[model samples]
Structure formats: structure tokens, C-alpha cells
Target: MILGLHHAQITIPKGAEEQGKEFYCKILGLLEIEKPDSLKGRGGFWLEVGDRQVHVGTEDDFDRLKTKAHIAYQVDNISYWRKVLEQNNIKILDGVPIPNFERFEFRDPFGNRVEMIQEI
Candidate 1:
């Protein structure tokens, strides 16, 4: 039988690892975990989200803003996140309403779409 998601991968422009860490680690408070030694030579980092991992890989010459693909983080308090993002000058986009859920979206510095959601 198939298992649950082990991790999800996202891309940022090559050589932007430090900037990515600033946002994903410092801003979002996601725990940074050491990548396997075998992958250390690669220009990217890993994050621990609960039991799962988010693999941030490096890529070049791609338009990230044009894509709707994103990761939706289920948070406990949606309003708190909205305020935090707004205070940081991140533009909050109204996400489509879904029954039993409140959510909003925003773009990271590299133009990655990120969503915050909480169940009603």
C-alpha cells in the first residue's frame, strides 16, 4: 500500500539559499534541519515541519509567479498569521472560500505562493 507524503519540494533561484533561509526560517519559524551529507554539495536547505520535511531546491531562469502551485500550511490561528504577514509588508491575497475553513495567500520574496489556513 502507498504511504503518506514524505516531503514536498520547492524551488528558489540558484544562489538564493540565504534569502530563502531568512524567510522560511527566521520569518516563518520553520525548523532548519541538516540535509543528508550526500546532498550537502547542492545549493539548498531542508526544513522540518512537524513530522514532514520541505525540501527547498535551487533552480534558474523560471517564472515562479506565473504558477498557481503552492503549499498550504494548516495553522491554528489564521488571523495571527495575516497580521504577521501584513506587518512584514507582505501583500495578503484573499483566497477562495472553502466550507469549514478560513484562509489567505501571499507570495514569498522569490514569488512563491504560500497559503495559510485554519479549520472552522
Candidate 2:
């Protein structure tokens, strides 16, 4: 058998799953997909964007202050995303320019780091 990258699961501290759903699903406009029936009791949510899927999991004892990894999304216009983030009160890090893309970073409500890149 062979395998390729299929999905990524992020663990959210304590009771932050609902916030994750609100941001990733509603704010980001990603479509939520129901988890398989056999895995119903597990706590999490899934979102589908094109062929990639992201899953956010809930953990009771996780510490919110700890440093965490993040996911990045490519956007058509960084300015538009900046406005959206500002409207939602999400803080955006000053962006740096790459060779062909401009990169901006931010953290989710639960402290999950995220980035947005737009072609320059």
C-alpha cells in the first residue's frame, strides 16, 4: 500500500471546539463535513476546502499558552483578508515580502497560529 498526505488534525485546548467551528467553518467559509459514524463520540470538526481537509480536535487538559504550530492558506488578496481579520478583531502580524508572495501571520482565538500568503 501507498500513502500521501490526506488530512491534518489540530488539537484545541479544553472547550474551544465551538469557537474553532465558528471561525474555520463560518468565518473562513470552509464546508463542514460530518465525521464518520463510527467516530461520533470523539470531539472535533472537519472542514473541506477543495481536495484538502482539516480537522480540529478537542482536548481537555491542553494548555492554551503553549507554543503551537499552525496552518497557512493562500488568498487572492491580502488586503481583503486583513480587513476581514480586523472586522473580526483578530490580530494580524505585520507582513513580510517573499520573492513572489507577501506573507502575513496571525493566531486564531484559541491561539492556533495561521498564515495567509498572497502573490505579489
Candidate 3:
């Protein structure tokens, strides 16, 4: 009854593609893939990591916290990711780098909170 995860979708605020590219590709190190021809005009970007893929789409209105959803990426180096995010002028959440798991949280231009974690 269980199947593999084909992909996941995240709704981004309108006009946030550039920032999304910076955060997801440059900062998070996810690979960008071409969107399917059928969804071309929908306005979004697709990213691949291992066997999973995430699709970021444009939404006229988005409320990050109100959506009660967030995505977490497992990283090998939290500090490096943190520095990358800060160097890009992205603000990170406070109180990160917990004992067993070093982590950092940041919001995309659309206000979606993304967290990077590494196990100790």
C-alpha cells in the first residue's frame, strides 16, 4: 500500500522566483530541473535532491505560518549552510544548532520557513 514519493509542492508568493532560485539552488544546493511543458505557464521551479523532488509554485497570496507546513532538508554541514544563507542576506531563525542536531531555519522570499538539519 505504500508508494514512493514522486514529488512535493510548495506555494510561493508571486514574483519570488529569483529569490527562490537563490535559496533553493545556490544556498540549499538542490539541482534545478526543467518544468514539464504542460505546466510551463504555471510559473514555478522544480528541484531535485536524491530521489525526491520539490516544486515551488507561484501563489498570489501566501501565509507561511498560517499554512502550518514546512519542509526540512537534511544536510551534512549546518554551519556551511548557515553561512551560505547569511552571505545571501537571508535571515535565520534564532536558537538553532541544538545538541543532537545542528540546524538553521530561514524563510524564502515568499515567507516559507525552510529548515536545514544535521545529526550529531
* Index of the highest-TM-score prediction: 1
- lDDT of the candidates, in the order given: 0.94, 0.80, 0.81
Task: Provide C-alpha RMSD values for all models, in order.
Answer: 0.7, 2.1, 2.3
lDDT for each residue of candidate 2 in 81-116, tens digit (9 for 90 to 100): 898888999988965667888888888887777888
**Which scores higher on lDDT, 2 or 3?**
3
| Candidate closer to the true structure by lDDT (higher is better), 1 or 3 | 1
Per residue, candidate 3 scores C-alpha lDDT tens digits across 1-120 of 768778888987777788889868876778999998999788989999788999998887556766547788888888888888888888988544578987777777677878788899
TM-scores for all predictions: 0.98, 0.85, 0.83
Per-residue lDDT of 99 in model 3: 84
Name the top lDDT candidate: 1
Which residue pairs show collisions in model 3?
A: none
Residue 8 of candidate 1: its Cα lDDT? 93
Two-way TM-score contest, 1 vs 3, winner = 1
Rank by lDDT (best first):
1, 3, 2
